[model samples]
Target: MKFTKILAAIVTTAALFSTSVASHADALTDRAKSGKPIRIGFAHEIPWAYPGDKNEPLGFANAIAVGVLKSMGYTNIEPVVTDWGGLIPGLQADRFDIITGGMYITGKRCKNVAFAEPMGKFGNAFIVKKGNPLGIHTYKDIKDKDATMVTVAGYVNVDEALKEGVPENKIMQVPSNTEMLAAVRAGRADAGAGTYFDARNLSESAPNEIEPTDPASLPEWTNNWVAIAFKKEDQDFLKAYNAAQAKYLGTPEMLEAVGKFQYTKAQLPGDAKADWICANR
Candidate 1:
């Protein structure tokens, strides 16, 4: 428990430290005119951002990032593989012009950096074992039935479960998504909560031992709008990205090329978790 608190504290401190750095008031325009290749930092989220063999980054977001930038006339875009926690800070430090991960457009996040129009939306939900030992059907099922939930450490999923009345102590926040899935399969946890697409991939990875629960039964007000993160003041990059995104939205050819890289269960639009990311969220 102490370790958990310490890790959370470190994350908070990292966020604060980054905020302090931005307070120096560096003009976002000084380096806005780089004619050089846009160096994009991307954290690998398999199936979403494919971490291919040798951990080469790939996937919808990776493809979209490269595709969008290339379409916007940047031919020398580079990919920087980073852990989930480090992706944002590296961007803040100017290590990359953009971190091509699927970032949600949330009010809290917008304060740090600008997010382009959502690249895609995702619904948040939990996955339970077949038969659902605790009959875990809803957020309330977790609360009233004394079920323990699993989540990636420091990820928003843990706090979302807490808001549903599941105690913080009842939630397990491991360091990575794989560990969270293992906990559920090994019976160390009753359920694992995450993005619906990711849950689908986990289930397909081990069909007999795991199964996804109905999203409708989970908390109602949850959605994730993934966008690329940029330096808060990088209005130029934001404009460039938005222009490219606008050009591709609703186009058949763009979607076809990008869809080829997604996981098997995620090939269809709004698969499994319907409505994708709720427009209202």
Candidate 2:
């Protein structure tokens, strides 16, 4: 009788443990459905995700994320701002429930965080001092001219520069675009590299100081896309988020939400799956 009692107790404990694990796995999705606040982490980058006049998160990625969340009945959202390099770390630490900054989906990142479908695609561009000093038009030119290039830390542009034969010593990784532009203006670097739109935005802001390289001059290898990121373990939440995204992405509503941030129909990611990008990139 004692043996049977012991066996029953073991089975009961096992069942309870299983239930607990299941509950934990579904907690994020459940919280969303219940109208609880879901935290979104974003980096301050122009036209991507940045603070607005009221310090509220605004930009293309932020708008898209908010739209999808609202469509899913997840109305309460809290925005968390951090440096671009800290976004993934913040998500992993439970500082936020998702990352919506115009984060690129790379293979290395795929190993760390789960990505939703891609939302936009773009190529690289360089911001050179007015009059094109150093003749820096492409990543290769930075190396050929033995010039230094600046990019935001943790940005794929850094990798693109290095791949084009620009030595590590010639690459300057700053904490943000503000520092990146400062470095170029201070002559600490010959050029600043970033997404095509990012470079164009900065150059337009300071036409007398810098100008963006011709978009057509950028190589095909420098092209990349952006997506939202989530913790790898939050598969349930990710599934729910993707379902909402499927219904909203590429629709007029999606474009309307992001168009103000300079995102157009051409920027919309069509038939681009995150899994394929992760595997190929």
Question: Which residue pairs of candidate 2 clash?
Answer: none
Taking the tens digit of each residue's C-alpha lDDT, what string does model 2 give over 106-225? Answer: 888999999998888877788889999788888888889999999999999877777788999999999988888889888999999888888899998898998899867977756777
**Which sections of candidate 2 miss by over 4 Å?**
1-24
lDDT of candidates 1 onward, in order: 0.69, 0.88
Worst 10 residues of 1 by lDDT: 267-276
Q: Cα miss at 144, model 2 (Å)?
A: 0.9
**Candidate 1 ranges beyond 4 A from true positions:** 1-35, 54-56, 263-281
Per-residue CA lDDT of candidate 1, range 1-281, in tens? 99999999999999999989765543433343355556677655666675677755578787777777767666665567776667677888877778776655555556566676666656766777876778876667888988888987545676577677898788888766788889999999998888777677788788988888776665556656677777877776577678887786546756765776662323322322212233343
TM-score, candidate number 1: 0.78
TM-score of each: 0.78, 0.90
Which of the numbered candidates is closest to the native, going by highest TM-score? Answer: 2
